[model samples]
Target: MSSPNGASEKQSEQSEAISSRKWFARGARAAISIPAFILTAAFVGYAGLARETGLTLLETLAMTGFIWALPSVVVLTGALSSGMGIVPAGIAVALASVRLMPMTMALMPIIKVQGKTKNWQLLIASHFVAVTAWVYAMKHLPELPREARLPFFVGFGSSISTFVFVLTGIAYLLVERLPDVVAGALFLLTPVYFLCSLWGAARLNADKAAMVAGLVLGPVFFISLPGLDLLWTGLMGGTLAYLATRIWRRGLS
Candidate 1:
């Protein structure tokens, strides 16, 4: 009947299909979680802030839809209103997004999605890109089958985008009705949720090292260089963490 090779090929294809389905399932779970809910609240706060700061609703929505990066949007909007040149505002936006490069590198291996197909997925995925989704993917993808990674990412990304779209619209309309305290509390959700997620996800020596380095360096760098604080803190702290890990591993060996 069937040759062994043919049977093996069929089995491999089936395995891949199964893996893809599992990835999507995991992503669906994350999409409906507390963290995702917090992200939506934070987006609402961002929309309110944009309106309060005199940005047009259309501009705010455009930023949410296209930029999809909160910190960058904040910096760009603030810089523009402060009379900064367009070039400087653009640079500020780019600098704020530098963290994504490291995030992308960390996720590339876990995703294991390859070639031209992956390119298109990446383009679509970038629209919903944010710190939360990246952290979730990094934490969960390694434990999943290879074929599922893309689907999982798609699910999580789509969830975040959908929530941002609706919540942002709501925030724009309701900003005036919401109390200042409530708006401030909503704005705090993103950072708090991110720190909690980071703590929960820090399973390895490298993660611990990085966290410690960031804790020590972030405040110091922030006081010294307000505008470039994140960039400098991340670079210096991450490098120190890497060096420390290497030294400790060598000593153990």
Candidate 2:
């Protein structure tokens, strides 16, 4: 017969696994209910953007799976097609993903599956840490048990990521068939939703400041700097905003 403590430990493990499954199932339901497809519409624009920048449908679809972030995909694809070499293109893509740094930091703690996931698995899961999944996870993960959060997020993210990858190919194929006006409208939807999500989720004074600076300086920098505008706009504008908010907070304190 098994020792009493051995049986108890096994029982506990089984209970945790069962609970994790329940949470994972809950996450799937939530993913369906939230209608994650609407957000992936941005990838449709991404597909169109990639094609306009000279990527074939297959290459664009590969990007949707590998790059996995819309802004990064757009930035890198645009640069590559413009004849920018791999080094410069890589730098530009990295700069565009600077925002994801903080998001991943906040999300990792909530979604980390300690003792269960390998390091490579965590790294792969981190790639799925984009705006839509982050927002949905942040809003819903708290309601779940610690054992379940990671599984739930993995399930939820896997579902949406797969959908996005598939649809990007479809969009590339269909963009040429759609009316020009409809195509243009579809392309704008992602950015519009991005801006709204940023505003809604911003909690810090610095975040608001960055947005203000980006809007104010983005066009000005574009006119002045030409090809390097986005990079400069982010560096100068984000830096100034950070400085301003730090100073303001210190003064108040």
Q: What's each prediction's TM-score?
A: 0.85, 0.77
Runs of candidate 1 with Cα error greater than 4 angstroms are: 1-26, 114-117
lDDT of prediction 2:
0.77
In TM-score terms, candidate 2 sits at 0.77
Task: Give the lDDT of residue 153 in candidate 2.
Answer: 84
Q: Write the per-residue lDDT of candidate 1 for residues 145-247, one digit (tens) a residue.
A: 6666778898778867777778888889877646789887987787788888987777778788898888888899889997688888888998888888988
lDDT string, candidate 2, 150-215, tens digits = 878877887788777877787888776556776688777766766776676666889889888988
Give each model's whole-structure lDDT. 0.79, 0.77
* Deviating ranges (above 4 Å) for candidate 2: 1-4, 33-35, 113-121, 202-253
lDDT of 1: 0.79
Give RMSD to native, each candidate: 3.4, 3.8
